[model samples]
Target: MLRDKAVTGMQLTLIIAALLILSSIGYAMGRRRAVAAGRGGALRLHSRPSYHGAYVALWCALPSLLLLVLWSIAEPRLAEWLLIARLPDSIRALDPDRLGLLVLDVKNLAVGNIVSREIDPALQAAAEGYNRFLTLSTAAMVVVAISIGVVGAARAIRGVSPAFRARNQVEKVARNIMLAASIIAVLTTVGIVLSLLFEALRFFDQVPFFDFLFGTRWSPQTALRADQVGASGEFGAVPLFAGTLLITVIAMCVATPVGLFSAIYMSEYAGPRFRATAKPMLEILAGVPTVVYGFFAALTVAPFVRGVGESIGLSVASESALAAGGVMGIMIIPFISSLSDDVMNAVPQSLRDGAYALGATKSETIRQVIFPAALPGIVGGMLLAVSRAIGETMIVVMAAGLAANLTANPLEAVTTVTVQIVTLLVGDQEFDSAKTLAAFALGLVLFTATLALNVVALYVVRKYREKYD
Candidate 1:
């Protein structure tokens, strides 16, 4: 048995290297050809020499690149098909799963993997043929792709003339590439949403939709057999969402005033030097990793919060939502402050002068004029901060405890939808089990909630935007 994985990788790398060399040559030759066609007069050329060079390079690289991408995608399936065709009737007669395993075993042997199957004469022959096929395929790809690149470069060089719209052609190709990339992005998002929706629907088949939505209990442990003890599962999401709302509210309570006030002061009161120095220092909070915040919350803030609560004769849980929410609030402060500062600064200075012309004070002018104008942006920043708080998992997992207590009290132990999703999918999971499938259900709910927040944010922004604009 022989493995050609390294050979295939080397072949692809060499092909890319060759393509780059050919494209560079095409670039230099195309520029010289265009210059010659224009009789060496810069004014006689239709487009710049650089544009002509780029046009030729694109032609040389694009078609061959497309071919390489298509071949790479199809190569594995083609190899499997060829392997299946060479296998014996008995191997082909096996069930799909067993046949697939046999094919995998053959591939392992062909790739010099430690195969569990006994080394038989048939496998050795198959490995030899597979290696030969791959070797021939690699050689064929190299010859075909290089030949296409060379022919395309030659044609482009021949087509170079003083009247040729090389820039227009290159720009059009770039535009089409951008359009394709945008379409791919949109299709990928749709694919992900549909995947989640279908899996959630599968989960709802075993668990009642109404029960999962409205039931208070959230135990997802289902009995494997009817006679098994302790097999009842509850799919209620009330506690998870409640805890999420509670923590978000606590976070917002801390973030909104402090962030907005800081923004107001920075934009309206602070000197240029102070704003420059303080703004970056403040925003550096946003750059801190959430895991670092998590450990900080778990080790330091959680204990401090507990000690304070006990001193006040209140029984606070060691892992309280207060600690997580406060730390998360600190993390999101920059999001609100930066955006609000920019928005306030964007409010026309003329509006401030108008308010002052009417004998209004600076504070009055800011409150009456600047604030109204920047209300939409400020609200947008707040909503973004809220969304950040909602999606955070590490801080909650560390400091809020995974108890899923449906309480509004910030001092209590609680968990969120994201924590539950991580919990259910942490280890080796059976997709069919209610426990694992519940993660998708929770994910779907979280997506819906986030979508609702975005919709509300859009509505608020639009409604207030017209008023000021």
Candidate 2:
């Protein structure tokens, strides 16, 4: 059993290493054969030696890798079916759920995990059989995979000739791989949208769509017992929407001007040395982790804001939206500054020269020509920053309290859609309940809102770009 366990652990690594070694050998052989074919200028090859090498390597590795993947996926299910088929008649005659639990116990016992039932003779025999099957399957996989790789390499090497279109074949394969990747990305996005839509539909069946959308309360706790408090939970999302908008507005107000002014200074006014030194330092803020930003907001910025508010005779919650929004704005500064600076720098030097030739000062040239020309990209950067602010979870979780108060006051405790989504889905959850499904509803709405924002931003960008052009 120990030997079987050791082999199972190391077999995958060994198989991959062996395949790599074979591919390297095939490449060397193919390149050598190509060079010999073109020796003494007797015949010119249609493709380069390197392309021939790559062709042989691809043939040597791709088939074996595919077989390995398929085998790994099928082996477990096959073994489990065989194990259940060989079980005792009494065990096989049990209910489906109980039989499944018994099989699970057998597997756990086989893997040295604590099993729920006693280790009887039947269970021990099943464990042994299971381990034996896995060992045999792994051994067969290694042999078959390597044998296929050798056959592929031999055939590819034999096919290599002066007239073989190795480059075209290799390029075709590369194009197919890229196309597959693009298809996978599109399918993945479609899958996400469908999953959210289906789950949110289920939630809407339980809670009215209008009530969820327009109600002011945000409590999601459902009572497990009839006499429990808050047996009927509110799913109104207006408070969450209000909080998201308030924080996003505050963040944009702080980020837009500071980030745009910084970009303008770095692009137009600062000397080369100063720009080079300051740009990286400013962009470094983006690399700082969000948890660190959350900590700073909770421990430092929140207290400072509360102190100032009280000094001025204003009420301030310990976890107000102001602190979270301010810190979030600071964290997103680099998104705007870096992108806007790059866009402004990309403006044609001829435009500046033309403006100066017309007797415009530096400031006048920037205001009249440069800013107008870069407005589209500047708006793009701000849109990206706004999206960042809306999606932020950690900062709001730490610095802003999870009280979904539908208020415009920044000094009050509030929570956004993302924060509520996290709150609803935390820990063990039953997916059939409205409490769990509400998270999906919130996610769908958030996705729609962001998509709408993107459409508007694109419209504004196109309009400005047409005017500038």
45-126, model 2: which lDDT tens digit per residue?
9998888888998899999999999998899899999999889998999999999999988888887877898889999999
Off by over 4 Å in 2: 1-9, 466-469
What tens-digit string does per-residue lDDT give for candidate 1 at 1-469? 2445676777889999999999999999999888788785668988887788989999899999999999988887898899889987877899999888888888888778888878788878777777778778888899999999999999999899899999899999999999999999999989988888988999999899999888887776678888887688888999999999998998898899889999999999999999999999999999999999999999999999999999999999999999999999999999899999999999988888888899999999889889989999999999999999999999999999999687888999999999999999998878888888889988998899999999999998897783544
Candidate 2: the clashing residue pairs are: none
In Å, residue 67's CA in model 2 sits off its true spot by 0.5
Q: What is the C-alpha lDDT of each candidate?
A: 0.90, 0.93
Q: Considering every candidate listed, which one attains the maximal lDDT?
A: 2
Q: Counting only residues 3 or more apart in sequence or on different chains, how many pairs clash (N, Cα, C under 3 Å) in candidate 1?
A: 1
For candidate 2, report its TM-score: 0.95
